[model samples]
Each structure stands twice: as C-alpha cells, then as structure tokens.
Target: MSWVTLNDMRTWLVAGALAFALIALFAPRIDLTRDAYDVLAVIDITTSMNTRDEASGAETVSRLRAAKTALREMLAKLPCGSHLGLGFFTERRTFLLFDPIEVCENFAAIDEAIAQLDWRMAWEGDSYVSRGLYSAIEVAKSLDADLIFITDGHELPPLPFSGLPPFDGKPGDVGGLIVGIGSRTPTPLLKYDEEGREIGTYAAQEVPQENRSGAPPPDASTRPGYHPKWAPFGNAVVDNSEHMAVVREAYLKQLASVTGLSYAYFGQREDLLEPLVAAAHARPLKVASDIRALPGSLALILLVFLYGLGAVAAGRALIRSSLNLPPPKGAK
Candidate 1:
C-alpha cells in the first residue's frame, strides 16, 4: 500500500486495457449523418451564358465561370452523406454527365466536371430554356433526386406568348430550388468558335443568324411552328438594344412556381444553401451502420499482454504466500 509500486503500475495498465477492450467489444454508438435525399445539379452551358457580367472581387467574369465558382462553394457545403450528380443543359436537353454519388467521396471529380462545363459542350447553338428545364425535371424524377437547376434563365426566343413552360409533374414530386445567375443589365456575350476558342463579344447588330433563312436551325426546329425569334438581320445596329444577357429573375421565379420549387439568386453561396439545408432536414434519412474494428483490435492486443503479466505476477505471489517465505526485494 506504499505510495506507488510495480504492482500498482501493472494494476493500472490492466485496468486501462480492460476498459479499452470493453469499448471495442461494445462498439460505441456514434451518430453518423445520413442524407434524406440526393441532389441532381443541372447547369446551363449555353453560348449566352458566356456573358461576362457576374462580379468576382474587382473583375467581371462570364456567367458560366461565376456559376462554376459558386458550384464549387456549394459542393463544399453539401451535407455529409448526401449524394450529388452533375448534368448540363444543352440542345434543349438535360444530359447527365455523371450519376449520383457520395458527395464527400467524389468531390474532386464533381469539381472537375463543374469546371469543364462550357458552351463547347453544347451540341447545338440553341438554348431552349423552358424545354431544357422540363428535361431537367424529367431527369430529376428519373433519378428520384431533388433538383437544383442553375441558369441565367435566358431564353433564345423568349418564352413563346410570355407563358410558363408545361410542367405536368405534381407538386412535391421533388423538392428543389432554381438558382438564377446574372445581372439585370445585359452584357455582351463573348463569342467562341466551334473549338471553344474565344473570338470576340457579340455586338448589338451581330444577330445570331440561324442560317439567315428566316427558318430556325435544324437543331432548334424540332417543335412544329416554333420558329425562334431571329434577331433582326441588318447592319442597322440598334445601338440602344439591351442585347446583353440578364438574370431574368421574373422568368426564373415563374419557372420555380410552375414546378413547385423555390427560387434564389446565386450571388451569395450561403443564401442558396440555406433552403437546401431545410429541404434535407424535411426528408427521411437512410442510416448506414459503421462498426469500426481497429480500436477493438488494438485494445484486445494490449489486454492480452497486460493480463499475461498480471497472471504470471499473481502466480508467483501465490506460491510465496503459501510457503510463508520472506518477501522479495520491492515487495510492499
């Protein structure tokens, strides 16, 4: 019972090992976050999105570039265990570039995919905004994921008759938000060649000639009687024309309303993600049990060593006690 001894040290070591063994055997429960739903992110990569208006610090960047930056920030904030998929709107279709995967695990690939998005990926020179949005809804439904549609909401021929697009999906089919990106004042869109090399900005009178035949291009002539409103073909440049791309906030809001979703500006990353957090909390989480085994293994090894030493020491003490022999050096 002296201050401290070899036996005391041995006792403490054995007790510590026993505690670790118990912890490992029981597999302490930890609360691991499980996402209630997956998110399908649809990005618009049209030529008009090349308008350099979105501000980043002191420099103005293209809408597409700003969108990619915002996406990177959003991806970094995605909830743990949440699943995310990337797609792009091109040629009036939502093309799934990749399927839903764990966001945390595959963030690098997601970032790469986001960065690679550009007008060059567009199969055609048409941005049927409404049609692309409809396609996004279908894609989201097929994936059974919540939708996050990011776009400038710039329609090539402006919504025909100024009406909302057809959305048959019932409300609550999926929860999501339409994130609008752009400025109110239009900016000249940077033109690019087929190879995606930047040429120059489209001037007011530089009408996008859809073959100069008063007929929609082959790729954009899919819908019957759907001749896109061709920019007036003439050298009389309308100097006052607001040809620059704008955010189209009203159109985006209307689309969100038609689809039973929310709308938000993409200027602030946190403001956009707040609604996502609410959407995530509203769904039912699918839990996955994770039983870690390493700690238990290490504890067991220490326990074995400690127990062996304790046993040998106990056995020797017992023999000496039985014979009533003199104490060994350091015996208490």
Candidate 2:
C-alpha cells in the first residue's frame, strides 16, 4: 500500500502549524486569479457512477459524490470574478444546464440547476462522447473558457474526424481541460425488473471495467441469460462494475490522444487535484495547493526525501534499460 512516512506526517503537521503561525507574520498579497472567470464545465450524471472500482479500495465512494465534492472543493479555489457554466451528457445528445456566469453572477441559479439533476432527465445514450464533448465546446465557441469534462467513461460520441476544432489557432476552438472520474474495472451494474432480478450489462464497445473495488470479481455466472425482452441490455447500459471501469480508462485515453487535451482523474484522489489546478493558465506551479501555500523551507526537506525515492526508481529503470537485471527466461 502507498503510505506517507511518519516523518512525512510529522513534517506536514509542523508545516501546517508554522504556516498558520506565520500568516500574521507577513502581509497578504492580492490573488490575481481572484479576478479570473472560469469557463464551461461539463459533468456526467450517468448511472454507472454508482459503482466503486476494485482498484481503488473497498471503501471507495461512488463517482457521483466524488464529482460533486470535487466541484465544491474547486469552487473554493476559483478566481473571484471567474464564471462557471454547466453541461450534462448521456449516450446521445447533450443538455446545456446553465449559461456561462461570472463568479459574481447569480449563485442560486447555478446551484439550483446542479441540485436539480436527477436520473430521469439524464437520458440513455450509446456513448456519444465526442458529441457531448463537442457540444460543450459549441456552446463556448464565442467565449474563452477552461472547459472541464467529467465522466465515468460511460460513452464516446461519434466525432467527425474532419470536424475537430483547433486549440493553438484553428477555426473551431474548444479550450479547457477534461477530468475523467472512475477506474479501469467498474462494478456490476444492473437494470432490475420490478421484481429486482438481474438483466443485462451496459458498456461501450471494446471497453470493460476491471475489478478494482475489492468485491469478488464478476464472473459469467453473475450475468443474466439471453432474453428477447432484454434487447435494451445491448443498447441500454447496465450499472455493472466492468463497464464503468472501462469507461473511465477509455475516457482519459481518448481525451488525451484524440483531442490533444489533458485530464485529471477525480475519483477518490484529492491530492492529484492541486497539481492540475496549479497547471491552469493563470496560476503558477508554485501555488501547489489552493488550500495553503507550502513553505519553501519545508518543501526542500520533502525534496530530499523524494530524491531518495527517485533514485531507487531511476536505478530500476536504468537496470531494466541496460539489461543489467536478468529477466525471467522467455518472459518477453
């Protein structure tokens, strides 16, 4: 298991105390991003989000809650004047929930829209990821935004290869980052009959969720038998673990490779957020986390420890590269 060393914990404690103690020591400076406005952020409200991956630990929370929490945490760090809009998608078309709004814009409007999200209106698509992605961009065509797409790999829309918008300077520009939430192995999703019996599974083509939630990995026996009435199973997504896992994995890869975009996985990994947020255009990497400014003195100490870990990793990579480490015979 990954761990924070005792020294690491103590170091964090000391740093936290020291920072808090020093806040009054120095005069606070103005935050440039405070005047900034955010762009459109699209979120997935699909049902597969209910599952937790086997890869993430047994107690891992659902994707839906994580998405909400991340947004909540992000809002706290948003630039003061920054505006945020909302969009949602399913297997087919996309729904525009809110128009763009500056941070100073109506607060209740956005929250009410978000709070109004229910499973019924979320719809069922076959996974038109490209369509959903582009749709958000289409709405933001006129305005500059840091578009954020959140989903659990539920679907990939049919994107026309020739119609993709440009980033650096093309006609169509859909600027922003994509955040994918979920795991490679999702959970066993099901569409229960009124009696609550098993049905079929829902997943994108060639994408299967890996077992990561520590639940017993799904076996074929867990799947329902062939049924003519269950045709929707093929088209309608079941809330199985396997599908959601694949959805998250495929979503990241596609956003990275297909769209020339960057992304952060927001499922149960809060530490990862700070870096991505730090990478935002207006922000410097120096502000690692929005919650607080890490002391340079403390960072130097942490770097020393990280160097030791880095050295081990470098040595292993070098050995593997040089063939200095013997391989199991015929392992390749």
Q: What is the C-alpha RMSD of each candidate to the true structure, in Å?
A: 10.4, 20.6
User: How well is each residue in 1-332 modelled by candidate 2, as lDDT tens digits?
Assistant: 23554445555555665565465345355433222545676777665655545233446656665666666556655655567787777665457777678554566666666656654455563555666666665666655665677776564332332333333334224545677776555455534344435466544443442222222222423445533344312233333333333455554556555654566666456543364454334422222223235444455555565566668867877888798777546544
After best superposition, candidate 2 residue 31: deviation in angstroms?
Answer: 11
Best by TM-score: 1
For model 1, what is the error of residue 62's alpha carbon versus the real structure, in angstroms, after optimal superposition? Answer: 1.6
Q: Give the C-alpha miss distance for residue 117 in model 1, angstroms.
A: 1.6
The reply for model 2, stretches above 4 Å from the true place, is 1-35, 52-60, 156-172, 192-244, 271-332
Best by lDDT: 1
Residue 114 error for model 2, in Å? 2.5
Candidate 1: tens digits of C-alpha lDDT, residues 193-269: 77778898777667442223443334445543444464323332224343567788998888888877788887644
